[model samples]
Target: MTGQGSHPRHGLVDVIHAPVRLSIVAALAGLEKAEFRFLRDTIEVSDSLLSKHLTTLEAAGYVQIVKAGTGRRPRTWVSLTPAGRTAFDAYTESLKKIIDAGN
Candidate 1:
């Protein structure tokens, strides 16, 4: 698990391993989706930084981003993909296994 190393095989999602990315994933785990402003504020990350992380997550097919609104500018909404939820679930399980290994 996440004890002394990191990797998918080690129960860690590399793309989501960074502190910020991990926090992003964790934050999105409980919601159907979160708006950009809400996520930025909650994660305490700058717009650029959050954009970068979102891009990474999107590239991995772990997150879905959509734009919608009734104006010239559309609001951004992001949520975990099915694959993402599955991955997160597996990661948590693996982490638990590691903790239980010595018990």
Candidate 2:
């Protein structure tokens, strides 16, 4: 994709581009792994909103969700996959280059 200037823009994988998803990924990058509620709170999104973003990330192979326990209060943990880390790094680098060009 192309931006307003001459810079080529990066495309969001099935996982990273959405605002909520991007926030989720950024938060996950800072933690070893995060619980569902932690991510929901960190991203300041509703439970349903977080869940939807997580589902998309999971489907895109960018994140993995582990479900523990078998009852009503099962704990769900989310982590970024190697693919996700690489994608996030690439996105940040691309942004940096764009910023540097304007300097």
Candidate 3:
């Protein structure tokens, strides 16, 4: 058994554990890709906050990013990579396991 105060962990994913990132992954999982504004609005976070989380997920290889300019405006799009999908699936399973353990 783990020491007191140390929580039992099985397949928990730390990166996606953050509420915003989890939402980001969940939103992207259902779509091929999503625009920055769409994700920002869907996640209900400020632009900077969304960008920060994207950067973190991108660094972790959980998301793919592409930037382009439409007319005079630059647009950013993000999608879950194959790795991201796998990680998200694992995260879901882990969360389920945690919940089931308490039952």
Q: Which ten residues in a row have the lowest lDDT in candidate 2?
A: 5-14
Better of 2 and 3 by TM-score: 3
lDDT of 2: 0.82
Ranking by TM-score: 3, 2, 1
Clashes of 3: 0
Q: Write the per-residue lDDT of candidate 1 for residues 43-97, one digit (tens) a residue.
A: 8999999999999999999999998995887799999999988888887787778
lDDT of each: 0.87, 0.82, 0.91
lDDT of 1 at 95: 71
Compared to the true structure, candidate 2 yields what TM-score? 0.84
Cα lDDT, model 3, residue 84: 97
User: Would you list the clashing residue pairs of candidate 1?
Assistant: none
RMSD to truth, every model: 4.1, 3.3, 3.1
Candidate 1 C-alpha error for residue 98, in Å: 2.2
lDDT of 1: 0.87
Which model scores highest in TM-score?
Answer: 3
TM-score of each: 0.83, 0.84, 0.88
Candidate 3 segments exceeding 4 Å error: 1-8
What is the Cα-based lDDT of residue 60 in candidate 2?
Answer: 80
Residue-level lDDT tens digits of model 2 in 17-47? 6788889999998888999988888779898
